[model samples]
Target: MSSPPEQHSGQGKTSDRASSGKMAPNATNAVSFFNSTAFDTRVNALINEWHVPGLSLTLVHQQELHSKAFGFATLEPPRNCTPDTLFDIASASKSTTAGAVALLVDDEENYPHVQWDTTMSKLLPDDFVMAGDSYTNNVTVEDVLSHRSGLPSHDDFYFSKRSSHPDDPRTVTRNLRNLPISVPIRTKEQYNNSLYTVASYLVEKLSNKSFEEFLHERIWKPLGMSSTNLQPDKTREVGLGDRMSKPYIWKEESRRFQVLEYEQTPEAQGAGSVWTSSKDYALWVKAIMNKEAPINDEIYKGLTRPRIFSNPEDDDLDPFCSWQGYAAGLESYFYRGHQIIQHDGLISGFSSVHFFFPEFKVGGVFLGNSENAGTVGSGILVKEIIDEILEIPESDRTDWNARQHKQNDEYEESKKESQEKLRKELSANDDGLAEPLKLPLDVYVGEYWNIGYKEMVVQIKDERLYIDASDRTMAFALDLEHISNNTYFLGTIYDMLADGEEVDKIKVEFRFDANNRPVRMGIDQEASLDGQLILYDRVEESSGQGQQKVVVR
Candidate 1:
């Protein structure tokens, strides 16, 4: 269903298409490589190998934009993707969020008090409270934006059921007090989406406008990225719905890609939710690289300043780089001796990678409709392009495809071994006697409450136990299978989000009161904390009428 590859080139003031018709030798070589037949063939091969339905690739060289698209945007309807086709750039939106905040920080006339060092307690004292007093009082806006706020990624807290104020950013920021802090304040980089939500809330408070509105007035409009928006629905509202790429996830069992629903919630707006096209995203990156408006020297410095090491123990030792670090919404690293500033975004079925070489004034943006497209597809192809531009010797070039394939195989094998070990453990019994439950299955059917996760309901359907968060749609529901005595495995609850082997690892244990009544439930939600379970108490009814003598821990 895919059409032939399409290419678009835009002329800039300093472009090779200028009146002089002159280009740097390196730029000329790069342009030739991008337009060559071999490059198109290579792109097609990568897309086919990775099973990516569609891909939009845009490059900025010599201040001009070169964009290309390949494959179908949607398989069933069969729409070929174009340079203007929009895809959810996921966490890549974080850079924009940081840029928006930087604009506010730089605008002394409008926001005199707002700065990178401004504490959240000072900004939103009532809403932004961390677990510890030190964290609650001293954590700054920079700390949160750079992901050094000491908060663990309690992603399920927002993604679970519809809480009291599910769509409200303030509610999300206020709930941070209930969650646990995994590390010490400013000790290490702990990527947390909730912190960005708090940052969005700060933007709202400072600007007296919604985060989306602020972004439009300041960042998007100035960069001429008209197609870029905060929420997915806006894409439809702007009459660009036809060009929006349908999200897809690779199903290993079926050896096919399955379509995934759009994430409609706005609570995590500042974290990872931006819809954009190759053309529009390239402009945004170009603006950043060219030191255009809204990206002044101070703003760019704040955006690219390395704050914390993302992975101190990353021993990959790839010849291309020396070190990597997190810088606000962007990540910075040495790629072939040139400082590369970039960010990768992956949410559900969409993936994107956008990076710029500040030294070379060259950049690349890749938007794809499959889950691992950014990591496997663009992540590999972009490096190959870089090698070509740098004129790296063929003998010295690293086989990134082989390296990635080997890593994927290793991960799959490890997961298979882990699943096998779990199955064996679950099937094994030290004693000959059966480990039957003392209480009936009905005793576990009840509502459980936790401050962090809100409410979870246990129900019996078709003679089998099932668990789901209250007010959540069926998409968040999970079937509960008894493992032993009082513990049950929440089947595949996070398999799609995390490792598939986690299906067997996520076990819920029911606790009993002195009278043998189930009173609470415990689940290992925070994988960062080894063997630590998040406890939820069972909700008891005041009246005896229609009350079941059941308890859920």
Candidate 2:
């Protein structure tokens, strides 16, 4: 990679504040940022504000390394963080397996002619009831490795006491097996830690070696990552445990960070639970960037290539993060034509961030023992580092991390304005409840269809109003609210007002007929039009109880 927009050659390792003035990172070639002060100030402010334990940052600029340390490793006897402080890398471990797969595939030593057709059933016991057929069975090892397994995140599965069972992983594995997969293989990208958990077994079946052994032989030893290890729960008692940083969550009432740990997940063994330091991870990043050295760029290219695109959601607050979309193992986005491969780690309280800019040949890793350390988005952090090193515009380096927030803010403003307009409009209307025109709950029973556009029905059985349409059905909440004399809202509500600056009113309205019968209709003021639910009522019920024919009126 070229040195920024300018040409600065002598700009690496020796470029630090405490160390030197002569070999400072050349400012001539790139926008050499002195953000260590600003960044440190911001970090300290965050630490004091959030009461985070420890955070370690490793920034590599043209082979120059800068590591900054802060805070205690734990709450009790709070120890100051050292440059060599070891933090649990959390799910950041996935990228390791991803890299291993890339290496294996590149080597083609025993790589199979895989697709989205391979079966876990063959690998495991027959009694295990995982969904899908030969199509899903044929799902390639690549499919699982890339997290395109078409299964919802198996997180809830871990809440059960069975999930925490020691020695036996089947408690967790059983939940994954029983999950009914909705999307078929190659249909949609779904993140599944369980599939990656099974990846260990997959590798073992093919290579006749444990996942640990394979990684050790193929990656860890080769990269000289002596510090990195897949910490097993069995050896934890014998003092052979990876030096771990337990996670923490903010307790508002107590106003202190509480230790957060998963009950049975340490035994999960396969998908997550790995530990190392920024210094060690720098070597891993360096190896990845300089792919030709050991694993070769072929493996690097396959692993880093954009297989699928995704927009990951941010959980700045709250205990867990919402679904962040998948981009193979690594997430990618163009920062002004410069592509970045990144991944984040979340194991309750502990958080880790890693991002690599392939174009600039630069990467950064941040391990935070604090839960809320993710407040500063990774994209901006990585870009600022890249921009400072390579002298690029910060705007070009910043990410779309703030996009959703901006959009949601705009939507909220619009909604507020719309609400004000609605308040004015409602006041303008002189109609009050002259008569409620309400009907008996049971009278609104039996599929009431709007006749043409679609079908929605209120099926009353055992005194419950169920909205039925074909295979889909939703029961109306018992506490129905009467908005107007003739209008009522049920279940979920949405206002379909026109573009701003008008008497904002519900474009889609539901109101009963003169007969006082509850009807499914959408109105934009003039007259009620049949809704989608009306399609199911085109025919009349002749002789069956609660079974009516559709007759689009």
Of the candidates shown, which would achieve the greatest lDDT relative to the real structure? 1
The sequence of per-residue lDDT tens digits that candidate 1 reaches over residues 30-86 is 666766667778777777777777888887775687777777678767777778888
| TM-score, candidate number 1 | 0.89
Error of 1 at 203 (Å): 0.8
lDDT of each: 0.75, 0.51
Q: Model 2, which residues run further than 4 Å from truth?
A: 1-35, 49-51, 62-64, 110-130, 158-177, 232-243, 261-267, 292-294, 312-327, 377-380, 387-553
* lDDT score at residue 514, model 2, on the 0-100 scale: 64
- TM-scores for all candidates? 0.89, 0.61
lDDT of 2 by residue, 370-459 (tens): 545544435235545555655655555443335434655776798777645543433324332223435555654555343111234455
Candidate 1: deviation at residue 230, Å?
A: 2.2
What TM-score, to 2 decimals, does candidate 2 have?
A: 0.61
